[model samples]
Target: MRADARKNREHLLAVAGAAIGEQGVDVSLRDIARRADVGLATLLRHFPTREALLDALLRTSFDGMAVRAAGLEASGEPGEALVSWLRDCVVWTTEYRGVTVLMAAAIEDPGSALHASCVTLRAAGARLLVRAQAAGVARGDIDGADLFALVAALAWLGDQPSLAPRADRLFGVVASAILTGAGGGDVEGAPPSGRG
Candidate 1:
C-alpha cells in the first residue's frame, strides 16, 4: 500500500478501536468512518467486514498475551504465572464492554474472522494451564476449554456495572479453586479474608 493509504488505514484502526472500546462492537461502521474523517468506501476498502475490523483491532492484544504467557512460563513459578496471566486475560477480554461476548462466540465459530486470534489466545492460556497442572498446582480434571470458559465468565462478570467492583475478588476465588488440590477445603465465593 502507498504511504497515504497506510496512514489512512492506521487512522481508521485507531478510531475504530476507541469507538468500539467506548460504545462496543455493535458501534456503527459509518460512525467510525466519520470519526476517522475517512469515507465509508475507504473504511470498507481497508476492512471489508465488521469482523475483519474487529480482528485487526484485537490481533495485537491477543499476540501480546501469547508472548506474555510464554515469558511468564519461562520466568515465573507455574502456579503464579498461570494466575497472573488469567488476571491479564480478564482485563484484556473486558476492556471493551461487549467484546467479551463477541470473543466467546468467535472462538466457537471457525468461520468468524476473529476465530484464529481467539484460538491463539486460548492456546496461550492452555500452555500456562498445562504447566501448572504438570507441577501439581492445578486440577488435572480441567483442560483448556474449562480455562477458556473461566476467563469468559470472569470477563462477563467484570463487564457488569454492578459487579465490576467485585470482579477481582471473584477472580481470585476462581483461581484458588483451580489451584487447590482435589478434596481440599471448599472455595468461598466471597472475597478472600482481609480484602474489601
Candidate 2:
C-alpha cells in the first residue's frame, strides 16, 4: 500500500476501534468515517463491508488470545492452563460489548470475514480443554464448543447493566464447574487479583 493509503487505513482503524468499544458491534460506518475525518467512500474503499471492518478490528485480538492460550498451555498443569486461558478469554470478550454475538454467528458461517479467526480462537480454547480433560482435571462431558459457549455466555453477562457486577463471581462459578479440583480464582498461573 502507498504511505498515504496505509496512514488512512490506520487512522480509520483507530477511530473505528474507539467507536466500536463505546457503541458496540452495531456502530454506524458513517459515524466511523466522520470520526476519522474521511468520507464514507474512503471507508468503504478500505473496508468493503461491516464484517470486513470488524474482521480487521478483531483479528489481532483473536490471534493474540490464541497466542496467550498457547503460552498458558505450555506453562503449567493442564487444569490451570485451561482455567487461566478461559478467564482471560472471558475478560477480553467482555471488553467489546456485542462482539460475542457476531463471533457466534461467524463461527457458523464459513463465508464471513471473521470466521477463520473465530475458528482459530475456538480451536485454541478447545486444545486447552482437551489437554485438561486428558489430564483428568476437567470434566469429560464438555467439549470445545461448550467451553466457547461458556465464554460467550459469561461475556454476555458483562454486557448486562444489571448483571455486570456479578460477572466476575459468575465466571468463577463457571470456571470451577469446569474443573474437577481447582477454584477458578485460584488457578495455578492465574493472576492473584482474579479480575474475572
Candidate 3:
C-alpha cells in the first residue's frame, strides 16, 4: 500500500483497538469511524467487514503471544512456561469482553479472517503443553485443544461479575488439574494451599 494509506490504516487500527477495549468486539463500526474522525465509508474501505476489522486489531496480539511462546520455550521450564503462557492468554481474553466467543468461532471456521491467527496462537500454546507433558509436569491426557478450551473457560470466569472474584482461585485449581504432581492431597475446586 501507499505510505499515506498505510499510516491511515494504522491509525484506524489504533482507534479501533481503543474503541473495542472500551466497548468490546460488538462495538459499532460507525462509532469506530467517528472515533477515528473518518467517514464510515473510509473505515469500510479499509476493513470491509467486522471480522476483518477485528482480525486486524487482534492480529498483533496473537502474533506477540507466539513470540512470547518462543521466548518462554528458550528460557523457561516446560511446565512453568506453559502455565505462564496460559495465564497470559486467559488475562488477554478477559481484556476484550466477548472476544472468547469470537475466537472460539474463528478457530472452527477456516475461512474466517481471524482463523489463521487463532490457529497460530493455539499452535504456540500446544507446543508449550507438549513440552510440559514430556517433562511429566502437565498431564499427558490433555492436548492443545483442551488447553485452548481451558483458556476460554478460565477467561469466561473472569468475565462474569459474580465469578470474577473467584477466577484467580479457580485458575489455580484448573492449573493443578493440568499439571501433574502440582499440589498434594488437594480437594477439587479448592484453592491450592501455600505449602511446599
Judging by TM-score against the true structure, name the best candidate: 2
Tell me the spans in candidate 3 whose CA falls farther than 4 Å from its real position.
182-196
Looking at model 1, report the run of 10 residues with the lowest lDDT sum: 187-196
lDDT score at residue 71, model 2, on the 0-100 scale = 95
Clash count for each candidate, listed in order shown: 0, 0, 0
**lDDT by residue (tens digit), candidate 1, 101-130:** 888899999999999999998999999999
Using lDDT as the measure, the top candidate is: 2
Q: Candidate 1, which segments miss by more than 4 Å at Cα?
A: 181-196
How are the candidates ranked when ordered by TM-score, highest leading?
A: 2, 3, 1
Every model's TM-score? 0.90, 0.92, 0.90
Candidate 2: 10-residue stretch with minimal lDDT:
187-196
Tens digits of per-residue lDDT for model 3, 1-196:
9999999999999999888877778999999999999999999999999999999989999999899998888887787788788877888777777788999999999999999999999999999999888888888899988888898888878877788888878887788788886522232443221110
The residue-by-residue lDDT of candidate 2 on 1-196, one tens digit each, is 9999898998999999889888888999999999999899999999999999999988889999999999988889898788888888887887776999999999999999999999999999999999988888898999988898988998888888788777777777787788885423443332222122
List pairs with backbone clashes in candidate 3.
none
**Model 3, residue 46: displacement in angstroms?**
0.6
C-alpha-based local distance difference test score of model 2: 0.85
* Sequence-dependent TM-score of model 3: 0.90
